[model samples]
Target: MSDSPDDSGALHLKHVLAAAGVTDLTDVFAIRHTAKNDGLPDLWTASPEAVLAYTREQDSRFRVFPENPPRSWLVFMDDGSHEGAHRSRFYGAYENDGEALSERTELNRSFHIKASPLLAAMKNRLVVEWTAPRRWHRRGTLAGDFRVLEIADPQVIPFVGYDKVRLTYQRLKAIVDDPHYSRWHSALSAVKGIYLISDTSNGKQYVGKADGGGGILGRWSAYAHNGHGWNKELAALPKGQCEHFIFSILRVFGPEAIQRQVDEAEGHFKEALLTRGKFGYNAN
Candidate 1:
């Protein structure tokens, strides 16, 4: 019964119910199922309140409540790291509205089915996660399989991976445009650094310094706007092709450092990154 849904009309929820040893799918308590879907671009990127608003669109009558709870539960998996693959797995769902289910905050949350048979079975086979996309729809009390939808892979999970961003010219735009990505933008803005921009097309590197009032974010903003950021050597190539540029932090400098020191550090990275001859894009 752990098999994923096939093109056939096989219901995944039925499989879950069977695994949970539930026979009749009667007055099943309908829980909200809000998952990442195609119709909304920034669905996962939204703030918690925004997400709550999106999920609360369902009719109040169908929403899950402690007093009018469902005897069973179900879900709809639209997209995830599974690459549109769907299968029942260990999950944890919670609501902090002082009602829905548990009032425990993210900092003090744990998923364990301490109750006997039925509740314990629900806990083991239940989908638990904060990623649901809709409030519990009371109408969907019947066990049903989730529909797997295709979406662009490598989904962007906010606050998950930012420190590792090797700034590309395109990604630079996101950093400037999206406040959610402001953590890196703010950190980079407060420091000085020697950065490396690699012309991924030719493997050429451009070593630059950002120690002025603007800091690294200021320097990168230029590249995001004008690819190559007015680098003489990069100017020789076509403009549209600058999309191949890759940026990354080479070295950071303390505020106490002077312009001359930053220039020296930039010089060091220029040599290290070999932006000189072997695809060296820096004319200077």
Candidate 2:
């Protein structure tokens, strides 16, 4: 293992390990890289041992090996100076060959820095380590960290599919009132067939294609009410929280057949939400 300053002149390290295959550790692990100080690319590494040592030094936490030979292990690191301190920003290690550890595996585990707590404490350098639990799986570890940054807020517009449709009933109720409502009202009437936004627990927000249309209400309602439908779903949901908002809508298909339009619109919405890190639905 070796350490050096990266392009931004931040201290970074890399590790190399002689392991069997990639799938030897945990099923899936993430690497978080933060800075020893506040900045970008705070985490860096090129090897597994480096990741392990970094995590141990930074957090001083470890888990007992599970398998006879220890299928996988992970390391987490941060640059903030605090004994046993947690930082939201950190790095992680994963098995080398793209293998991940199964959560079902019984392994003695402990954590020095919970991701949320770590993110709350420090804004400096951080890193993490992850391992898989299969011998035939990938080998080695992957390293990276996290950093806080600001992004520009997108310009959004409200979409009213049916001007005549009243908001008196719940939003889904309004949609169920008329199939034609989908034809006129869209999250993005300005764009043509694109309806990208939907109402969720957090008001108007981007939803996946699978969660697009009025389907979002159904799925969420199912989960919220222990499998209920319609009014019952709404009744079961926390009161005053079912209100939906129009975050942004896009119309990619213009005056196409209804089926074709649904397919196209759903695809476009899925692509858009995915690009923004909002993968909420199970497409399958």
Candidate 3:
């Protein structure tokens, strides 16, 4: 029942039930015997609303058991036959724990009647309810045409104050230079975007788009060494204080679109760093 449905059969049943105005079993089963006599599935499906309406009518006297775990319920017939209806209540239909049921066999046997037809009707309704797809559901947006903007703010946090930044850069360089580092470099190339490491503190600014060679992590490994200007800046941060942020652009763009986007983002990153003020503008 938890599986997504490929068709609309489940929805059709809900619509039919709503139209019948029969919400409980009393009114639902009270219909002419001829209507009830039809095949159980057919009868229930034919007017589900009526059945639901009828069940609601009996809400006052129906006794549900296992108050804590909510195992089952007993619906008594007005005829006072002592044999009440025993319906299983499960959080989910697919969870079948026979061991628990066997333990409670005595209680079940005493309260439950062999009303297969009624049980089948109830099961059918539950199936419909469980299987129906949620209406008006929206899927999350996929990352597609992503762009990396450059950081233009010259006055923003400079990669100079922290000692950890320099150490992280050294570690990164060592990681990328080793033969084993090729795989890591390849992985970073696939990342959609990379944040320029501005300061060891709260100074993340999206700066550039990575060429589809790998992911952000991979790219970091690649640049960890090489003593580039950015690497030197990162190396200056306090040990263990430097951080890199990478964003993926799977949903937003084709190659050309992402390139332009990244360019613009880098520009914004620069502007933000210069204007934001916390990035060590006065130190140097």
Maximum-TM-score candidate: 1
**Candidate 3, backbone clash total:** 73
Ranking by lDDT: 1, 2, 3
**TM-score ranking from best to worst?**
1, 3, 2
Candidate 2 local lDDT, 178-208, one digit each (tens): 4444433343232323333344454333433
lDDT of 2 at 266: 65
Whole-model Cα lDDT per candidate?
Answer: 0.51, 0.33, 0.30
The better-scoring model by TM-score among 2 and 3 is 3
Where model 1 places Cα greater than 4 Å from the true spot, the runs are: 1-163
| Least accurate 10 contiguous residues by lDDT in model 3 | 137-146
Model 3, 8-125: lDDT tens digits are 4233222222333322311211111112343222221234444333322211212432222211221211111112222111111111111232324433312211122333333322
Highest lDDT scorer: 1
